[model samples]
Target: MAGQPTYMLGNRNKSSRTRDAQSINILAGKAVAKAVRTTLGPKGMDKMLVDSLGDIVITNDGATILREMDIEHPAAKMVVEVAKTQDDEVGDGTTTAAVLTGELLAKAEELIEKGVHPTIIASGYRMAAEKATEILKTITIDISRDDRKTMGKLVKTSLTGKGAGEYKDFFADLVIDAVLSVAEETEDGIQVDVGDVTIEKREGGSVLDTELVPGLIVDKERVRPNMPKKVENAKIMLASFGIEFHKIEKSAEIKITSPDQMQMFVDQEERMVKEMVDKIIASGANVVFCQKAIDDLAQYYLEKAGIYACRRIKKSDLQKLAKATGATLFQDVTDIRPEDLGSAELVEERDISGAKMTFLTGCKEEKTASLILHGSTTHIVDSLKSALNDALCVIGVALEDQKIVAGGGSPEIELALRLSEYAATLKGREQLAVSKFAEALEIIPQTLAENAGLDPIDKIIELRSQHEKGNKNAGLDVYTGKIVNMLENNVLEPLRIKTQALNAATEATVMILRIDDVVAAGSRKGAMPPGMPQPDMEM
Candidate 1:
């Protein structure tokens, strides 16, 4: 507590009297929603979001777009969380979830001002969400295990409008196969534990040669060069606990009766040490993980024979190593490596537990070795460990999830659609929240359209009108916009105009109702800031 602030919030106000300001929060949440929903389908266009730093990100991925945005309103942050939650749950469909949530919030705001309580709006929304999920499930197609064609379609469908390249089918199939190999049937859902499937790229290594190892392998050398350079047909012993070198009785001390007796004691010690070494060699274990000290003579003998001896190996690593190597591991070192050396880096000898491990392999021979570290700080090790974990997680995701779509604007459009549907079901003014949410979804497509030198508002209107007449698709249907499609008489996917119109109108209404205050914290006494003031803020 010494370094902590004695009185935090010293200059901060505990309360504000802005409730009477009669301003509606334009619902940054709603805005985000509107921006995302404009590009809901294949017809969807991309968004170009440029931040204050002039950094530009062009994407339609809802999660990425919101993440990149410079949002200031606290309410909008809640919308962002909705997207985050979706990402956590499905690892995909985040944009769709977020756009829906934003539209819901926006519609709720409108109905709230129309004398409807937030509770009713929320209840209805909960019901609708459940219904929507049910609807999706009904429409969801069942894919056959043998239907490689459909699988290809699914992958291709997932990759549509994604990064372009050659050999996409090959890559997709490879990813799919890897994922399918680990797929496990469970009662709740299909479970695939991909934590161990690592996808790594070396500077000069081919992707095809990537393989899995039973245990960890590193590229390191023995702790000491003086230790055995190599051991032939070696018996390996692994242990997680330490041991004692000298034995003692219940109440024994250093009190020798005679010089002869003392000499005998010394000889006994030497015999015990020699017996231990002989047992290891006889057992055919060339590698031993020792938790205790080794006698100088035994160490010298082992070193001369080119046996691998490691000390202070972590218990976790030992267990994994043992499992991989199939070597006999115990608290005591009497057992040796069995007929099978097991697929392990090496049978290590160590005292400590909870240390991360990497096995170093020989370039020519796949011989396992250990690098006994001497000195290092905690931070350096921890950082390295974290980096490894991140790398591993990314690789695992790639191996397991098998796909990643463009984020940012793509998701927002979906959110808008879901929110617009909710708005339609609302009974009263609280539906305004859903409307606001829908409006928020439009920002991206509109921005994109505007940037492309087209009339975004007019396009929105056209899309909305077409969508209202039971058109299932409208907004960003990209494929239908092609010149070849026109010649081929390819009919465009119908747009859901009613929902789009509702989203746009509600956003406009909310934005107008919300523009009550124009406080510029940086300006005072009629003085302007360095840069040109916001056009909207100018009186």
Candidate 2:
């Protein structure tokens, strides 16, 4: 019998595999990154991404765009991951990290094709990154503790045009202080607890005060004169949602076949309602915060009894309100509070066209301790809460540990350039990765050109020519509609967030690239990906 033999492409036999995983990752990462990067600098244009649901989101925010898009490629997934990591590390800066990383991989691909080993490139990249970090440190100015001016600028940037108006100055100081207070003062940068607190707009107005109350606020006084007139030192309590507790035999109404039985059920219900309210009053709870579900009888009795009750309290806003007023929550009225009470001016809901509820209790107008609401719509607010929560999780990280970078994109750019510069200095072909890194640095500018709809090729050539002629600071310059020198004048530098993001994205990408294959610990066939060398042993 004649046996057929198979030949392998490049350097492999039929049974042998090469770790082209890095190549694929780098390629995919760079391609998508390139597409996104083109939208950088002032020249960057907006992208309108419409999801399957026809929800259209338009922005150059890389994480947002990538997140909303229907991305499928595994490598592209990694690129998105880079953006995600950037976003996770800092509230802003995902785009720059993705852009820089994609360019790095792109340049690395060229070097790899030219015979540079992936390991060599990785090592050089590592060196360049370290150098970049050092250079960035030199440029970073510490935000003075008292320099409220710059701090105010950062806050204003976060709050302005978001319906914050003259309130910007007021809320800016509040937000900055709250962030600073939550975050530790360190040489690296100010740490902040970056969670999104709920803000609601209602028909009632808002109140600003720090005095803690021990009871609920009701629109009317207690229905009965016998009901205590505002129990002094009332213990305030909250509930998950509003509901009256009344026990009934299983299917009691079904068995009741006569009017007398029905009347008994009604009377029992009334009695239960009264008992719960009386218990709350007896517990010395002068106030209660609950969702709008008070039984009519309970409401009538509570009003006559003089309990301060605020109904329809948003579930989300309860936490901050609780924190601000020192109120405790109870599922049943029996668990009322005297010490849990807090005070707020009458709960007035403001009907701003968009969303406009600014709930501040126990803090002066100029003082910090305010919530900034993003994504004003009901759905958008929910989504924004999740996004802001992710941001907050990152803040938790800051709370738990000292972060390495203060700013995001600017630091990332600085780091990328240094890594590339160091690669240029390496002694041998190993320097290929370093040089590649430097080449990757071009991605930022290249992306800017792409986003601006300008000729990236031409801009690169122009920048290169200037650099070769002795322009030390040769980089991409993007403007609204044209390619301009970033160094030319008055170009707003990337935010501090990008720096931290770059480090995280770079690390994650490199880790994924360095691995030939991912092993599934427990599964049939060991969960090995195709076209990569499997681990010597499977778990």
Candidate 3:
């Protein structure tokens, strides 16, 4: 017993393992939050995220910023997911979700410090979130989808902080028209699909040149120079397969015995191409948009037929064209019929930015729409594209839900005020956690004020007072540095943005709080989370 040496299992001990993983997770969440917090409000700053490869991104969009940075911390990536979820689900409010989650974690960190368990804090925060959403439903106003003026305001609000702020009026009008063009009235409610709206960016024009096309556009030209540049009352044939020989599926060698046989083989291939073109012509399709290439011989025949054809069209473009023109996508040229052709008043190939692009216009009944975005610099165009996309998604959601809420941080203030009242009704430490959740909600308005260079505390006090008086619409008017009614001022957002942001932020915060350890894959060295100490390093 005295001579035996002790053995170690995996060279691990409780002291060697990372302690305070939950604390580290919360800090990482907060760090990610602070990184994007300044980009929250209309006056928020843009983040210049440079990746490991030295690629640069200058953006105020939260989801874009988080995505661009090379994040390594597992908990930090969870924070990033908050942004992605908010962006994917609501199209706006990624910054709000990230900031709220960070603030929630910060507040919960304090509750943990006070000896309250993480689960208790999570449940309390959950309760506060539910209460906040209920208050939101009460305060939101019904927005009639047919009311263009009000709907335009909803879009303008979305575009306010983005680089497109200067062109809000023009862009808002364009966005609403695009949304309404694609929206359909169903038996249950109005349904909108954002994919129905396509955005095309081109240089050499100002933002003012941006216009809405009622149909679709593809950045492709007529396959041959001899093809007609324009076709009137076009009967369109959309094909997913190439028009040449219909595709053989496999390659083979055709050996010729003599010059005469080679000539015959060539003639046979030409005749086959001619027959395929004849079939399309018999179907009465004067225009063709092929998702695949058109053979040179087939293009020649198509040109001879005076057909306007665009080859190598994207699958998405083909589908939208079908929707816009009532076109049927053909896999077989043999089954062509007049009934399969889609009608567009005009199919024209136009030179845009030195490239040939085709436009299918005059389909007034079709639900597909296109937005042509123009700007002098790629940066401005890229930023405008993002803003316009957000604007469209927000309006679409608003129209679908038939409900809207005041933006400019008014809703958060109202939710905070209501949540605080709800928190007061609870007993014990859970009440404190709920109250902390309410305060976390206030971070939105505070950030709005801070980003505007206004006094955050004064803004919060004024907003809280206004909310107390049943003026639920009262919110920080960052542009004016005053407390005003967001609805009266025409600053509005979709109700889902606020509700979804809170839902995502709370879920993420709770998830981070619930984690007690993080074991990385192939972790060879004893793990020590950032800000936690290693015994050897301390020595």
lDDT (C-alpha, whole model) for all candidates: 0.45, 0.52, 0.85
Model 3 Cα shift for residue 120 (angstroms) = 1.3
Best by lDDT: 3
User: How many collisions per candidate?
Assistant: 85, 57, 0
Task: Residues 1-539, candidate 2: write the lDDT tens digits.
Answer: 25967532322211212355565566667677766764454445557777778876655567877888776656677778878866766665567777777767767777778777777777767766666656655654444455555555444433322223224455544544444544555686555545323322212122221111222212222324444443443445566645464555576546888999999978887787788778776766555667556766776776775765556766655665565455666666655666555544333222233332323333211112333343334443433333333333333343333322322122334444556667666688767766666666666655656656678788767666654554434454333433233333222222345446546655755665575543322235334344334344322
Query: After superposing candidate 3, which stretches have Cα over 4 Å from the reference?
Result: 1-19, 49-56, 245-257, 334-337, 523-539
By lDDT, is 1 or 2 better?
2
TM-score of each prediction:
0.48, 0.67, 0.90
At residue 94, candidate 2 shows an lDDT of 66
All-Cα superposition RMSD per candidate: 12.8, 8.4, 4.2
After aligning candidate 1 to the native by TM-score, how far in Å is the CA of 374 from where it should be? 33
- Candidate 2 local lDDT, residue 157: 36
Cα lDDT, model 2, residue 177: 47
Q: For residues 1-539, what per-residue lDDT tens digits would candidate 1 score against the true structure?
A: 78876533222112111322222243555676776765444344567777888766555556666787766654465566666554443333445555555544555555656766545545444444443343333222334445555444444433343331123354445545544544555565455444323332222223233234322442223445676554444455665443334577577668899999999988888787677667666665566665445557667656665667666665655554564355656655454434533333333322222332334222122222221221134322322222222222222233333332222233234445666787788776546544554565566555445544566677566555544553333343333321111112221110111222233333333333343343443344444333212323222
User: Tens digits of per-residue lDDT for model 3 on 247-280?
Assistant: 4669978789999999998898889989988998
C-alpha lDDT of residue 473 in model 1: 31
What is the RMSD, in Å, between candidate 1 and the native fold over all Cα?
12.8
